[model samples]
Target: MDRRTLLTSSLAGMAAAAASAPETRAQAGGSGPPPFAETMAEMTWQEADAAAKSGASVLWAFGVIEQHGPHLPLGTDVYIPSAVLRRARQILAERGHQAVILPAFYWGINQVSGAFPGSVEVQPATMIALMADVLSSVKKQGFARVFCTSGHGDALHNKTIFDGVTAGRAASGIDAAVLFNAPLVKRLGLDTASPAVLGFEVAESPARFIDVHAGDPETSAMLHIHPELVRKDLLPTLKSTDYGPADLAEWRKGQEAARAKTPLGYFGDPASADASRGAARLEGQAKAMAEVILARVGGK
Candidate 1:
């Protein structure tokens, strides 16, 4: 079977397993209003305190304010993760657990898009330090469990998150895990069984490595969540650039040449993107995330 078909089967199996999964402890707060009631940014300090006292877990959504393509906005990364987290939060609420989503982290390591307009870049070290601080602070606030997620799958971006989580766990002495797009991809059974399997292998798939950036998956997601921001006029002509799979030699080729390889900052056939498919994918992943959240907070 092809990789995509394999992934669909794996995710279906995971979902079926989740259906019979045991109930997890409510570490955030007791049953409250639904997850749709409010976001962390919208919660009052008093309400937050009460939830903490009740053992509410916090969900930190990661998104970068980087260029998507000529057709999509700079906030595509942010919008997609926030929407998926929101869906997971709703599911957690149904299970009598309280979860709150923090505002998106707009500043991320946007090395690839640094040359592109609208990219708010941060040093890798700085992003890691910042994530550590934020997560450590969350633990100090008495939330025993905290979940982190990112839709963007750049190698450096994933490195920052993993590093930050390691640092945060050490500093706070709490349980933490980053639901990186790669592990999600692997868990869903995409790609071969190489120990070095990278997220972009599947994420970029059958296109330029840059396909992970503004490809069909991302475009469809943006269409599902924020069609208003998508420039329909530009979609018709957008196509993957000439950049192919890279080698160690390409790593030495430097950033300028890298951008030159895919000048438009996009790399896949977005023409295939569909909102319904995007919605289904998002829902499945969100369910997987909710299952992980429940297991982490208090499952055997």
Candidate 2:
């Protein structure tokens, strides 16, 4: 069977099995938000206002609708960040700190992925404006700590959003503090020497030695967190390309050469992906993110 068909069939079966399984408050033996049923709706204004009033820290997961390889969902970018935020919320709840997770931002700057079908690219200026407006609204509601998490591959775009939030705070004199997920990811060590590290590449250094895009780490992550979304069986086998010696100079040169050389718009080995790897990466990211939020929220 084709990858898509195989993925669909497998996911359908998994969902059915999940439905038949008994529901529980905790599955991973970790603590955080009380349960999915207990947390408020992540996206609504009313929810944000209520959460702030209840003394909860506000966290937003920024995502984009972009192409992953032929085997992954277009919303993979969105799901990864959202999953991290959800996991963070759970961790914070365990520490007695209430956290309100904002909804995922599916529209983002996706120039590289724009050539692919189903990818939507928002202009950089447009994304900055939208994020500023959202944060402004949240600050006005008295959310003291605002966390911005992104899973998209564009480091520059993510930095723009972070700078925009900083500018918004300065211009409006809002007391809110914004934290981006990229630095947090690095601090957490989830992308350590893995193919997914390329996800951190920017236009300045488009080609990194690691395959950060739709490669092993990313695909593995999807397989673990949202297995239904990955079509592993139907994916094309890719001949792995190394950007020569791994260094900053070579990395930049490789990225420049890659833009002209690779047409698929992805790097890394997807065949090596596994659900267990994704779960480990996700847990690491969540733990590190939770610590940051707690520190920001003044938790001990």
Candidate 3:
């Protein structure tokens, strides 16, 4: 069988093993959220080699140091995805799973907010090559599984990263995959071993009338995950920069048009954000991410 096919066929057994694992979430219970210390940057070579030899999985949360409607931090994309992965890490620990969280990759393609002052972007080829190289190196280090995810929503950002992932897997023959944003997962026809599609579902998400960028969904998330980064005074003033097909086309045109379209670099109603809702969505996304990892690593 092909590698993908072999991986698919073994999913059922993996889930069963996870379900019957000795450590239960209840037994692993604690107050507040978890503090993930299994960071690749912090680990010594010997420690990393041991985890790889033990068949541990890993995470790479790609982010963008870009604008978020002038009200959020430049690292909003970085913070949110990294936070989700941290929560996912906690869940995996509860299930007797172990995985290292790689250092945040912040230099990603930024089309939507490119025209804004704080938005940082790079060539598509750079991102693609980076993805391939990273995966290849992960395999060389002996890791058999890895999940690449991000909170950024630019269409090209999604396309380029997936392209990189495919190229990386083909060249290195590694087991690297992505827990892509919900829209791209469906768009690319990718599916996970888990029953639920692990991507972030845009349509059914916490976003209201329109919540793509610094709108309710993202704003509320920051409020819960990193409230200090949010500009409380600005939340009351931000308005909806609603998105549709036309808006998407404009965004894709380039940074100039994107800047013209949303001068403040926002695209949703941040005014409607709620901290409580933010907390719930963070946990929800974390649970889904954890499920994806569990199914991938539990079987072995």
User: Which digits, one per residue and each the tens of the lDDT, describe model 2 over residues 195-279?
Assistant: 1221221112243456667777788777877675566566557655454345323323433353444456556667767788788
| Alpha-carbon TM-score of each model against the true structure | 0.75, 0.70, 0.79
For each candidate, how many residue pairs have backbone atoms clashing (under 3 Å)? 6, 7, 1
Q: Which of the predicted structures, 1 or 3, would earn the higher lDDT when compared with the native?
A: 3
Model 1 agreement with the true structure over 1-300: per-residue lDDT tens digits: 999999999999998987778432232233423323356778888887888789887877787888777788777887788888889888998988888777777788776667777888788889878877888887777777667788775667766776777788888775667765555555445343422122321222343343456778888887887666666667878865544556323522435654676577776667667788778878877877777667656632
> In lDDT terms, which candidate is top?
3
Q: What is the C-alpha lDDT of each candidate?
A: 0.70, 0.64, 0.77
Give the C-alpha miss distance for residue 254 in model 3, angstroms. Answer: 4.2
Better of 1 and 2 by TM-score: 1
Greater-TM-score candidate between 1 and 3: 3
What lDDT does model 3 reach? 0.77
Rank by lDDT (best first): 3, 1, 2
Tens digit per residue, CA lDDT, model 3, 170-286 = 879887777775667776676645332346443355333455778888999988877766777778877777677677677667688878878887877888889888888888878
